[model samples]
Target: MTIDDHKSHLITLGKFLKQFQTSNSVMNSDIPGNNKFFEEMNQKIDSAIHHNGWFTRENIIFALQQWSEALTPRNLKLWLGEYDLSESGDKTVGIVMAGNIPLVGFHDFLSVLVSGHKVLVKLSTNDRQLLPVIASYLMHLDSRYENRIRFTDNRMKDFDAVIATGSNNTARYFEYYFKDKPSIIRKNRNSVAIITGNETKEELEKLSEDIFRYYGLGCRNVSKLYVPENYDFDSFFKAMYKWNPIINQDKYANNYDYNKAVYLMSEFKLLDNGFLMLKEDESFGSPIATLFYEKYQDEKELKDRLKENEEKIQCIVKKESNTNEVTFGQTQKPQLWDYADNIDTIDFLSKL
Candidate 1:
């Protein structure tokens, strides 16, 4: 495929997706009617709660939109190639999807598809519906894509390259099993923030969405905070209080109780003011109902700490230094150019 071919294919896929998005029949009927998808998703959310204790539909929607936006022809060309479909040979790529969050592995799926390689995907039970639905739409646009893609339940073998996502512990297992092949093994990661005193109440409230959305289960969710010690907790809590409706949800409440009890039983020192927990920490990731906030005396110290922790952090949402405007929810809205780990996925695929 040439660069033109790639662009044409992407434009077609994009248009197809947009059509599917508006088509009531496809959107409403593609998913199983027996509540199977919901049941499976609920079960996955339950497991995530048991392990991490938070989940939200907001994160899932945010992730899907980010992916769709990034799939535009212009953006896809930048990551893939300007107009070259020079084959990297007959590459069979095995992708192991992660069920930690909904559609967590779509990026990997897009990478494989855009590369024009055969993709054998092992669907996570948590995300069974989304990928198939997406593939159905893609196939509707171009049957060629249907032939290139395959979903499997069997152990992957005879693949030229592999991409797997899992916890830090499971990553070791993936490395051992797929060591002989070229692979990208993704481990667990989380985002954090540096909250200067200059932020407004509205900003803090919006920040609450980032923390609570997806129950703080996503790698992009802000799990830690950096604030000045003199920063008043009164205003911060007031801003966060607006999101109290989050706890009223049955699933969120279940996770809240489970994690809250665990924290109490473990005797973790919590900065509790009735609803949320704030703790001081050096790590970027924190448990749900628990947020880590470190005190910094000056901007230089805060910048230094951010730089020191740059590799571990995914994003930082803060107010524009000179301006009073808040940039809170923007962290989750990644552009097409925002390649994961700053690695050019198209370049990686072209070589495979």
Candidate 2:
């Protein structure tokens, strides 16, 4: 099959995904194979929720919605236009997905396949239910995909190159194991927001989505805040009121309570809103139900510090910044071309 063939299959899969864009799924009759696949897809969503508490229905649907928007014919063309896929080498690529959020490693999977390479994927135990169903849908759209996509439960071998995402510890293992091969081994990284005192309330409200989406499980979620010294957090906490319902989830509330207790016992100062805790910390990666923050006296110094530590950050959220800052509320809604860790997946796959 040609590059257009792979693109067409993905476009069809995107149409199927559009049906489940929201928790209240509405099947579209125009979608091919919808009658056979729609019900099973919904069933798998339920199974994913049961298997991993973090995979909530709303979050799963949110991921599907983002992908549906991303996989349009125009979006795909614009994204792939920069590369010459016709000359892309046909090698087998192995992908190790991270289950931190629903469909987290899909872009890498899509990259390998669309770049004219076969993919051998090892699904994270926490995210196993969804992507294979997607693969099945693609295969149903065209038989050729059956030969190109494969998932493994055991050790993976026979791949020319690999892309793996995991914690800092596992990243070391991936680096050593794939040292002889071309690979992209991703380590732990977090996103942060620079809170100017003058941000509109609307922007802060939108920033709440960046903090609370997926209950802040995704690496793209804003885990830290850099605010000016003596900045009042009244407006910030008020803006975050919309996500108060998130605390109703047992797992989140338990974390909030436990972390709050630990902070109190340790005599650390904190700002509490009954659902989320704000603690002054210099770290980028914060624990769930808590947001770490640091007081920045100078904007220039803060940017320089962040730039120096780019390896530890996945994204920066700010307004009117010249650097590669993600707009507020958009950390989770990255475009198809927005490569993670600033690494180009297509470029890596094309080289392989």
Best by TM-score: 2
On lDDT, the leading prediction is: 2
TM-score of each: 0.80, 0.98
Cα lDDT of model 1 by residue, 137-174, tens digit = 55655577767788998898778898888888989999
Model 2 Cα shift for residue 64 (angstroms): 0.1
User: Candidate 2: where are CA atoms >4 Å away?
Assistant: none
lDDT per model vs. reference: 0.67, 0.91
Worst 10 residues of 2 by lDDT: 318-327
